[model samples]
Target: MSDIDTYKQQGFGNSTGFGARPALLIVDLQVAFTDPQHLGGGNILAALNNTKSLLAVARQCGIPVAHSRNVFDSVDASVWCVKVKSLKDLTETAPASQIVEQVAPVPGECIVRKTKPSAFFETPLADWLHQKNVDTVIVAGCTTSGCVRASVVDCISHNFRTVVARDGVGDRALGPHEASLFDMAQKYADVLSCAEIAAHLRGALPG
Candidate 1:
């Protein structure tokens, strides 16, 4: 049997499916990550475009939208910055810490500033989602193998249905991106294309 089939037989990959209420969670699509000159940058333009498309659909459907940024203040720069030196440049006042203009958060959207890989870490994301009655989270973001994966796992752990848009989340290299998507699909979240998720959201909305 193929690996996927074996995983299915082992009860590893099971669909939590989309829930009645869903929110779009865009994770770390900041200027530092989108611009190749800065740390965490690579060919993420395609992923950004896909995320923008998803954002448009979410807005039309009136789905609650939230964004996460990896922001570190001077005193709060923790050990994470030591391991990833580039993170030092992502201070709260830095321009690179801002969300990319292409997929900027609009009014009424929640922007969660985190100092770690998972958006929920020491952040009010869970509380915010609960306040909005968000039972499911549709995620899109950068560095699929890193922050994206970390956040998805946390979302599932928090008992929210998690969906990761394959095209909307990317990594610096294709190999890691593909691997992370497959891993998340088999273990954490439902991995689907941006178009597929958008279509589902469109249909799920009120008439």
Candidate 2:
């Protein structure tokens, strides 16, 4: 049997399924990570497009949306900047730190500025989601093996039903991207395609 089959046999790949109310959580799809010259340049564009499509459906369905961006005013603020030099580019005033225009936040959407990998860490994300009555969160964004994975784990820990859009999240490398998705699917969240999520949203929403 394949590794996935073995995992299934061990009862590791169970689904938590969807919840009543869902929100979109876009994590760190910033210019620093989307532009090749900066820290981006992979299959990230495809993921961005998929997320854009998902965003449209969520907006039409009137679901809550939240975005997370990693911004540091200075490298002295955290030791993480010392460890990962690329993070230095993500300053609050830098253009590279801004969320890409494609999936930019619209009016009334919550924007969470975080300095850590997990969106829920030291942020008001949990409180915001609670206020919105969001039971489920559809997560999409860049660097699947990093911030995306961290945020998904935190989402479940916060008692939110988490769904990771497979095509809507990307990484700098395919190996890490695929590995992270498999890891999340087995333990943390339901991994579904953006199209699957859009279809479900269409059916779930009132006309």
Q: What TM-score does model 2 achieve against the real structure?
A: 0.96
Best by lDDT: 2
Collision count of model 1: 0
For every model shown, the clashing-pair count is 0, 0
lDDT per residue for candidate 1 within 39-156, as digits (tens), equals 5555477899999999999999998999999988888788999999889888888999999999998999999999999998889999999999999999999889989999999999
Question: Model 1 residue 200 lDDT?
Answer: 98
**Which pairs of residues clash in candidate 1, taking residues 3 or more apart in a chain or in different chains?**
none
Model 2, range 1-207, lDDT digits (tens) per residue?
999999999999898888899999999999989988888877788999999999999999999999999998864358878788888778888999999999999999999999988999999999999999999999999889999999999999999999999999998899999999999999999999999999999999765
